[model samples]
Target: MVLKIGDARSMYRKFKPHLLMVLIQLGYTFLNFITEASFNEGLNPYVYITYRHAVSGFVMLPFAYFLERRIRPKLTWPLFVELFILSLLGVGFTLNAYFASLRYTSPTVVASMVNVISSLTFIIAIPLGMEKLDLKNPRGMAKVIGTLASLAGVTLMTLYKGKSFRSIWSAPIHMGSSSIHENWLKGSILGVASCITWSMWYVMQAYTLERYPAQLSLTTWMSLIGGAQSAVFTVCVEHKPAAWIIGFNIKLWSILYGGIVCSGLIIFIQLWCTKEKGPVFVTMFNPLSTIMVAILAYFVLGEGLYMGSILGGIIIIIGLYLVLWGKENDEEEVPMRSS
Candidate 1:
């Protein structure tokens, strides 16, 4: 009985990160839907993102200071430089592009396209020597095939917008400008760019995490630096002071949710997951968010669900499973090979 209990504990420990990531992605799905709705209400994307990072930075700073006070390593210039680059890729540019894409496309579209990050991360990892791809190995082959399948799904979703299945329920609040129509092509490109930058961020995070093991401190730094960087862009683009104002409206709600949940909470959870599992492991769960977004967007926002999206989502799921299976197999082999 003791042996069996130990085995169960071991299994749980191994799978915990994966489970946590799935839950995080689900939370992110809802967050993304709300953010898209906010964007539609005339909220300037740059201003919104700037506030998000600032809030996230402030929230994280205290926790980082308190929780990681003792164990925090000495701040070095090289680390500072890395954090700056991470801020640019992970928070500033990535989110700015992401919110801008939402202005052009639906939340579901952005979520679906973002799944390409998993594939992109996997590919980039190989070149960085962070991931090994041996064609002869079944696991490696599965990874490659899964990456291709996900990319294909992204392509289908971008190219084909079949008949719309709009929901009966209307959004409770419609506040923003409705001037922007859906430009699938431009949105898709920007979405793809966001994915790439995000993937790069993941890779860099994994690399940096090896040296700086303090997750909270790292996240705090990233948020603070990224917020400052984003502020510059916001000031340049949104010259009016009125754009930054957050009253008791959807805009306020959006910034609070984004700053607290998306940036503050989500970044910590992701950093923890990445520390436990590699960046690829964390990324592979992105497709789950796509499905979540599709459902939430359909019901809450009354967004149209197209046939192509359905089919593409299905393909992405299959690919996601393939990659996960491959990773599992690879991990199982590690102990055996070592022994």
Candidate 2:
């Protein structure tokens, strides 16, 4: 009985990050949905994101200071610079582009597009010597295949919007009809740009975490720096004082939830997961959010569940499993090889 219990505990330890990340992604799906809804209600993307990062920074600062006080390393100038660059790439550019894209497209499109990040990360990591791509190794082959499959799934999702498999009761919120196709093309471009920057951020975070081992502290610093940068941008871009106003509406809710939950909690969870699992492992779960968003959007936004989306989601899921299996196999082999 003791041996069985020990085995169970070991299994739990091994899979705990995976389970935690799944829950986190589900939360993020809901948050993304809310963000889209807020955008439809005419919330300024710049102001919203600025508030998000600022609130997250304030919320996290005390916890990071208290929790990591003893073990936190000295805040050196070079380390500060690295954090600033990370903030610019990850929080500032990635999110600005993401929110901008949402203004032009549906949440479902944005969510499906994000699945490409896994593949992009894999590709970028290989070039950086952060990931191995040995064709002879089954694990490496699996990673390559998984990346290709994910890209293919995303492409299918973008190109084909087939008949609706299921219809919901909610009314669809239309932004506007003027330059709709052009806006969609523009949004797709920006979405891809966000994915690229996000992928870079994952790689940079993995490298940064090795040097600055305090996850909370690092995240706090990133949020603070990114927030300040975003504020500057907001001021320059948004001349009207009305743009910054947050009243009792979806805008207020978006700021509160985006800042507190998405920025603060989600970043902490992501950093912890990235530390435990590699960046690829953490990013592989993005497709799960795409699936969640699809279902949630259908019910809440009265969006149709299309046949193409269903088929694409299945392919994305298969790719996700393949990448995860490859990573797990690689990790298992490391111990044996070392032994």
TM-score leader: 2
Candidate 2 whole-model C-alpha lDDT, 0 to 1: 0.84
Candidate 1 lDDT over 90-137, as tens digits, reads 988998888888888877678877887887888789888877778898
The per-prediction CA RMSD against the true structure, in angstroms, equals 2.5, 2.3
Residue 49 C-alpha lDDT in model 1: 86
Tell me which residue pairs clash in candidate 1: 41-176, 42-176
Count of clashes in candidate 1 = 2
- For model 2, residues 206-288, the per-residue Cα lDDT tens digits are 99999999988988998899999888888989899988877899888988898888888888889999988878888888888
Q: Give the TM-score of candidate 2.
A: 0.93
Runs with alpha carbons beyond 4 Å of true place in candidate 2: 168-182
Ten residues in a row with the worst lDDT in model 2?
Answer: 173-182
Per-candidate local distance difference test: 0.83, 0.84
